[model samples]
Target chain A: MKRLTGFWAFTLLLVLLPIVFPDNYYVTVVGGTALMNAILAVGLNLLMGYAGQISLGHAAFFGIGAYASAILTTRYGWNPWPAMSAGLALTGVLAFLVARPILRLKGHYLAMATLGLGIIVHIILVQTEGLTGGPDGLSDIPGLAIFGWAVDSDLRWYIVMAVTLLLVLWLALNIIASRSGRALRALHGSEIAAEMMGIDTTATKTGVFVIAALSASLAGSLFAHQQSFISPDSFSFFFSIELVTMVVLGGMASTFGAIFGAVVLTFLPELLVVFEDYEVMIFGAILMLMMIFLPQGLFVSGQQLLRRLLARRATGTAKEGSHGAA
Target chain B: MNIRKTLSALAMGTLLGLGALHQALAAEPIKIGSFLAVTGPASFLGDPELKTLQMYVDEINGKGGVDGRQIELVHYDTGGSPKKAVNFVKRLIQKDKVDVIVGGSTSGSTLAVMPLVAKARIPFISLAGSVKIVVPPQKWTFKMPHTDAMAAAKIFGDMKKRGITKVALISGSGGFGKSGRAQSLKLAPQYGIEIVADESYGKKDTDMTAQLAKIRDSGAQAILNFGFGTGPAIVTKNVRQLGIDLPLYQSHGVASKKFIELAGDAAEGVRLPAAALLVADQLPDSDPQKPVLLAYKNKFEAKYGPVSTFGGHAYDGLFIALEAIDRANSTDKEKVRDEIEKTKGFIGTGGIYNMSPQDHLGLDLSAFKMLEIRNGDWTIVE
Candidate 1:
């Protein structure tokens, strides 16, 4: 009941936001981008926060998804829907193959392995002049349409992205509450212990990794279609790091935390536009301060403060009632 | 209750602020939208461009504005991403409601936003150097820099005149480098020159000795580098260290004082096609671009620091847009776009711009002056 209420409240907020900012371009364009980042961050939180795995090169999956859709639709003349599905499948397979070998390493080693994978993908995208159009990239990719009704306008894109993000969050929440979710939690707690308890550790890790990569793939496909262009520069290693930052800054284990972190990071630059040349410097300082003040992530610390305040209020009420009885 | 009061107060304040900003913007006569890569991987190119735009707009406004109306410049930094460029362009057209847009710092970014300008029906003057930006010649899009094809043509034309039948090619793995390489290869036979050797290095590469050695032994008469930034400078130093005696040529991408400083004494005698602004002091008194180039160079260098061709590209785009806006005498986008198309014999830092229905760039092959590094300064090869 509580989870459903939270989901509905979020949905209501999403639907109401556009009404408040009617005809606003920032809401539709920048806000739409925020929603995409939220989608990527939500799935990544599952793997990093729950499955206890790190992927420093997650942008590789994003690039693969974007490139697959772009190439299949533009070159092979496939429909956008099937092209997106094909991209998802290809990204899933790539993640499965890479995750099997790369997931064995723990901590920083795994980070470096994923980083290597990302760099290789970026290099291929740049070097392969015939297929990916080299660095200039492929443009004029058709927009996503259903029965000839195209999702073209910024408002339409925002709605589509918001709905997709909701579906993803709902799925993530359900997974976090399911039986396998417990197993994943156990795996996160202690991988060797979970294996001794008969949980399929490798399979669980790879499953979550593929899921996270698929999420990134979906976001990338949408990005390609929205911009109507795909480039090697968009899915570089820096993007992967930014994704991890979103996940951590939001509070890794919390789904809403991921979304909140994504929203902040996405809108932070725009909000800091008034800072002009001092923008980068101030952005860095704020991020540093956030890390210092709330090392457990912004959402986790904020929730803690709320709980503390509620507890204090309850205790004060109890004392007042006892004094009246006396 | 206290927190609620604070939140409501903040909301009210924001609303009032927004209302005031809206009124202020409505009162402005003309709004010019600018999107540049002011702080990212391409900031080295964008920082100076932003400075030039800021200084120029302020100067125009100070001189009683453009045609008795204040010029309101709305600039946004793209951070060198096509995705961001797309978003900014949309905001510029839809939200800011600017009459004209002058922006796009890189080939990829410019190409990314090219389709949008036509859709919005706004006059767009691109600062990017890709030939494709203006090759098909979208109705509304114009470019500032000399195209990659023109650079290739100029280098090949010079090489052909010098009887250099065979040349070695080295390029970086970037959009600019790849486009230049393609143009060179495509125009080689047409210019009666043969590509005897071809090599490439990554954009972040620090040395090109191995590539230089291969080009040295390729039996080529001269060498050409289709790259920019540190990569070309590294190749230049490597060519000198390897004792390759053939004449060296580079693309306009390396036509900056920074390239000379990076390449050290090895940059001496290396020729490339560049805007006349590079050799502005050396330009003849009667040269059409001399005065405009001198004014821009003096103002830019005096305020900021050393002036580069990248900034010169921004200056050309701004002036062109301003000229069209003034001539149109209205903020109507279509009218301004038509006025820009009709521009003829307009002196700019790049060259004399002459716009046509089929040609948006409005500059000829003569726009590029082949310059060589003489005493660590740009000198006309002629």
Candidate 2:
């Protein structure tokens, strides 16, 4: 009951803050983009946070989603909604096919293999100029429409993205409280132990991998629709780094942390205009400071402090009771 | 304890609020935005353009600025990514509210911003070379360098004049390179020339010996290398290493001194169409562009240390934009664009710019001077 109330409260806060937002530009530019990134981060968190698998090439999946939706709607004259669905399905299948061979590798080796895959995809997009429009990228993608209502404004896009984020977060939270989620968490703690307990480690990892890929794809599709453009350069190695940074900064094992990290980092660059030259340097410094000072993350640290205060108060009352009995 | 925490929070909030207010109230300078590949693989092109832009902006500000408003240039490193270009342009138009935009190093980056500029109705001048930029006319976009079509015509016309009939072509699969190859192929027959051999490589490819060998063995009279950024240099080096001694015909993009330095001895005797500023010393006093060329060349060398064809494009683009603004007597975008379209015989660093509504490209064949690299220096070939 407590958890449900907390979830509802958080969802309400997310919906209400934009209403009180200072300006439309901020909501659309900073808030909308951050929300979109939050969706991606949350999806990635399910794999990295809950399942304890690392992926450095998730942006390739993101690109695939963007390109798929872009090509479908622009070239074939399909509706935007169907294009997004097709994009997600395509990414899911591709992830499933690659996950078997990829799941065989572990640690940094797995990371490099995924990186190679991303590079190949990038190269192909650049080389096939006739099909992909080469490096100029596919432009003028159509916006999303539902029940004859078109979302043209940034505020409307934000509402749509925020609703999608809530759905994804609810599903993720449910998974975290489920039996399979426990099995995945067990594998993260000890792979051998998880296998010994008949948890089927490989299957769980692959399943989670595909889910993460789908999440990335959905986010990418949303981005394409919102920006009305897609390009291969958008999903380069730098984007991969950024996604991972958001995941790590928000505490790897915390669902809420992912959203928090995405929001903060997304707005960090905009707020740090005076440090334009030192943007990357300041980013590095903040990461280091967080790792040393907060360690678990801002959310985790706050929770820990609250727990400590509550425990101290309870112990003080017990000690007073013992003194009164004496 | 709760009061103390609230006070601290309030103090922090007040400080942040004050900072925001200060930034908001800061003098509204004439904001000029730039989209450049400042941190990616294409930084070599963008870094120099950025430096030259800064030098020009500083020079103007030092001279009391235009109409007493100091220029504030807000640059975003697109990292050679078109998506980032889109995002940065959105921020520039919707957030920063810049007056004008300048300096895109790549055709992709420039084209990405065209829609936004058209929507916002602001002047955007690109330093990229694609003819597609101004085509299908976005009401606000303009390019400084000669387009691929014009350059193609110039190269083939020069080839015909030089009595070169059979030429081999080699390019990469990039947009610039592909466009160069396509335009050259389309214009080849018009010049009474046949493409004896055609080959291509990827952008990240280092070894072009296989492709060059194939071209060499095809018995072509000359090699028409149509690519930019180190690819031309690589082709030149490989041609020499493979011992293909035919005269080389390059695109205008290879007019950079960096290409010569990269290609070493192989770059010598390679002829290409170049702007007058590149070979100013070769122009006689009787030449129509002699004065403008000499003045720009001296100023560029003194200000930016050395001059390249790319920097010359910046100088020309900026001068043309400023001239159009002056003619219009207001910073209104449509007025400036109209004035730019009606430009006639405006003495520019790149010959005389004569723009019309039908032809956004201001310069004609006469804008390019046929020059060859002899002993690491440009010399007039015709």
The TM-scores, one per candidate, come to 0.95, 0.90
Please tell me how candidate 2 rates in CAPRI terms: medium
Worst 10 residues of 1 chain A by lDDT: A317-326
Model number with the top DockQ:
1
Q: After superposition, how far is residue A154 of candidate 1 from its true place, in Å?
A: 1.1
lDDT of 1 by residue, A1-326 (tens): 76567678989999999999977877888899999999999999999988989888989988998998899889998898899999999999989998899999999999999999999999999989899999889987888996777897888999989999999999888888887788889999999999999999999999999999999999989888887877898999999999999989988788888898999899898788788888889999999999899887888777776766776788875542222100
Per-model DockQ: 0.71, 0.49
Query: In candidate 2, what are the lDDT values of residues A97-190, reduced to their tens digit?
Result: 9998997888899889888878878877777776677677777788888787788766788888889888888888778778888998998998
Query: lDDT value for candidate 2?
Result: 0.80
Question: Candidate 1: where are CA atoms >4 Å away?
Answer: A319-326, B1-27
lDDT of 1: 0.88
Query: What is candidate 2's lDDT per residue for B1-382, written digit by digit as tens?
Result: 9999999989999999997897678544567778877667787667767776777778888997666656677887766777667767878888877767787878877877776677788888888877778776566787777877777888888878779899899987777788888889899999999999999987778889999889988888889888878888888888889989998888887777888899999888888888888878878889988887787678777866776666666667776776776678666778877887788887777678887776766778888888888998989877
- The per-model lDDT (C-alpha) reads 0.88, 0.80
